[model samples]
Target: MTPETGKTSIPIPERTRPPRAARRGAIAIRFRPGPAAIAAAALVCLLIGLLYLALQIRTIFSDQLKQEYAGLVLEAVERAESARNQVGIWQQLPDATEARAAGYRHARTELAHRLASLAALVNASPSAAPRLSPASFTADADLRDTDAVLGTVSAWWRAQRDADSADVRLRIAHVARTLIASAALLFCMLITALGMYAKRNRLLAGQSHEFEWAALHDAMTGLPNRRKLFATLEAAATKLSARSASCKIAVLYIDLDGFKQVNDSLGHRVGDEFLIAVSKRFRESVRKVDVVARIGGDEFAVLVREFSTNAELGEIARRLIACVVQTDLTMGVGMVSASIGIASFPDSVDDYHRLVAAADEAMYRVKRNGKNSYAFADRAN
Candidate 1:
């Protein structure tokens, strides 16, 4: 408790600056992929899986067709063998009767027709059929020589069928490998697309942050502007009204003395530099929680959020004046100083909305009475 004011002053703890790595982590946390990006990635994966499944199903159907073709070849070979057996049985009969002869001729014709059909089927499949010698089977061969010919044809069909089965398996494997490679390529493309999308989102987010910062802050001095100052005051007022605390919020409306002369005597570049230098000094003169804002030309405002006595506000005003005087010397403008007007919530005005106006009116009073001084809004008259 202060002996002079009889009010308790709550000490505000100093906020420590976070480490560089921790700040970077905070920035990284803000640019995560949204729901749309995740959903698109999932859909791409599903498409890749479905394409692989469809390719595999097609290979299975091809294998089924191959099996059916092999079965048909086998059935034709068996029918030819049965006809050859009947021809042999007819020729083995002892009587040379017309009926027996006719039966033998009929069996021979059937066997020849079946052999021709089997040869035609085998020849149709160029991938599986092997080149056979002309002497291997002939249409004019003797009826008694049918067994050797049938054996040769049977052996060739079996070999061809096995070769075709092996080729089908090889083809299926090639198709599977091709499908896998295609899927991998597609997956890579999708991943690239997702990365590009994420990068675009991050770029847009950074632009939005820039626009927001520009809206509330001055471009020249990098201080909060009038809009930002008003917003902060409104928030502080709401807090004060809710808590009904004894600690008060104050606005120090400051106008630079002899600033117009400097702008007229020196170039605008020098004037801009002068403003920047003084703004830095003003920022350094206050507590970490206090906000220093450049509201307009040659005018700035400092907000003191928590203070116990009027004496503390007076001290801040003195520091601001001294900082301006010191900065002006380095810039070769020795005559420059600050005219500050002090106003407080629940002290000068009933509403926080009038705080800045009241402070502005008080600053004019300082100008009228003599520059380079501070005065209170309530005592301006």
Candidate 2:
């Protein structure tokens, strides 16, 4: 209450909040990943995996070629050693015959050819160049110490080959592990992006649905508005046109009597509450298929989809009148009553589009005669 104005203040009720579980459920629904997101993530992972696998296979192939070349070089070294030993044995013969001399020359020539081949192989290999070079084998002439040099070169080549093979295997293993970890990390990132995309889409869809509902329904009473009622009437007329002649549709335009007086005597808040209460009663008084809509302030329209006789519509009108006249104590301020005018397809109005106007005209006739009663459009006409 305000001390200066001496008027009591009514406190507005606080808005009720949703439960924690309900909020969590709403979040889960809004962010749940859709099939399109999952499929896109899977496609990205598959493409990356294929690219990585191709690179790994190429590395393995190159390493295999390296191993094959190393083996060939080792074989060349062995051949050179054998040729050198043959040349030495020929030189150590007791008789100095022409055949022995010719044989020694042939063996030395073969040893020189073998040594050139080993040098070419070793020079071609980039990794072997630091430890073994072409000059290392060719610098020693007369081939007296060739056997000892050959033995050392053979041991070095074998050790280098084993080391290279081990290194290649270790590198491939490390790359495989790294690739696996990178792919897993990429997959996780894609999934998170997919979830975010789905959540945004869900939020947009929810907002769109809310906008559509708000457009069609009355904001205060949550009932169908004038536009929705007209649309329903058009649909009902089209549907009944295809059926038998007995199937008919009707419209009842209702105007509240003495509502303005109540609204003026009491406040607008009471008027709004009274409207909501009566609207609920009007809705409850009709069948599930029937539509009760708030067309204007202190005015409503009811769509009866199918009715066999005028009496059936009259009964519905009486029910609506009762919904208003038998108001609860909370809303019964002043002498509030309902004056309803009924109009049916192929009877009061030739066209379905004119049904509401015809009913409205009849409702005004009721107001002129007395308030709180129902009348047919044909009778009013």
Candidate 3:
């Protein structure tokens, strides 16, 4: 070695930051959280769960208030009967008959005021029970017809306010207990998740991504939801906005024909299975670049990112119509057809929203003209 180098320093490699994955892997092996830490976490979770249960009691309390108000209505009906009996006694009185008559009139007025309060309550919270207009109740509740008033009050209580408060309280208590237990389990899971996270955060991240995708995509057919469709449409719109003259996007709105009749005849389970099978056929028939989405009940939308001409779109539409007719479904979900409408950007409309509306209107026209066919918005009269 040279004398100058030997005096200056010993040879050493350059230092750099550790890789995130390696550091994360070391975390699990380096330290373990104690039982005390876990217990504290569990307590925090339990408190949060109790807070949720407390909020649910607001709804339970509202139901209890309804029962109390309904009981007041029954008492008013009893007061009406008492007033009628007082009227009879007043007529028989030889002395101080005028004072007794006044008392009867006071009772009648009190009953009317009570019913007015009850009618307001019923209106504030609408009930399926027969309409209880205060004027109608007062008209029918003549002093001579005491029994009718009593009968109506009893019937109202049975229908509108029959839900017992005790039942609501009991159910709430059961749910609270279940949630508390779930909180404990969640705490235990949290620690386990932490341990796994220490080993590999990427794995945990992947699981979270899957849950988010499920929310964005349909559960039944694994297609994009309406929200996803809107996002995709907006993205496409933005890209085409710059090159309005050259670029184009197509939105195909498809509604199944005679689906409701078959769904009603077979049952919802069969209908669901039928839709799943139909979705598979749609995925297979469409271009790989296109986005197929299940937007609503028996309604599917396809977004064509790019297309050459009207003939190209027409060919794709014909294939989709034929796919539905040719595909067979399990669970006895018989022959079904679709009515498809097509609208293109820059070709049909200037606005993106107007483009969607145009497609929807054209689909309805096909439904009216004849079923099991495709119609272009530009061609539709």
Candidate 3: stretches off by over 4 Å: 1-200, 328-334, 379-381
Q: What is the per-residue lDDT of model 2 for residues 161-257, given as tens digits with 9 covering 90 to 100?
A: 7877886797688678867876786777677677777887899999999998999999999999999999999999999899998888999999999
Residue-pair clashes per candidate: 0, 0, 0
TM-score result, candidate 2: 0.77
Report the Cα lDDT for candidate 3. Answer: 0.74
Total clashing pairs in model 2: 0
Worst 10 residues of 1 by lDDT: 131-140
- Residue 37, model 2: Cα distance from true site in angstroms: 12
What TM-score does candidate 1 reach? 0.72
Give the Cα-based TM-score of candidate 3 against the true structure: 0.47
Model 3 poorest ten-residue lDDT run:
131-140
Model 3, span 1-381: residue lDDT tens: 765645657789888878999888799657655445666666677777777667767667777777777676666556655655655665566777677768666656666665565556555553354546455346336554445645775686765566656666776887778786876588676776677556566776888899889988999899999888878888888987877567789988898887897779877887887788888988898888788999899998888988879788788788777767765344445557889999998788667877677888889989999878988897333
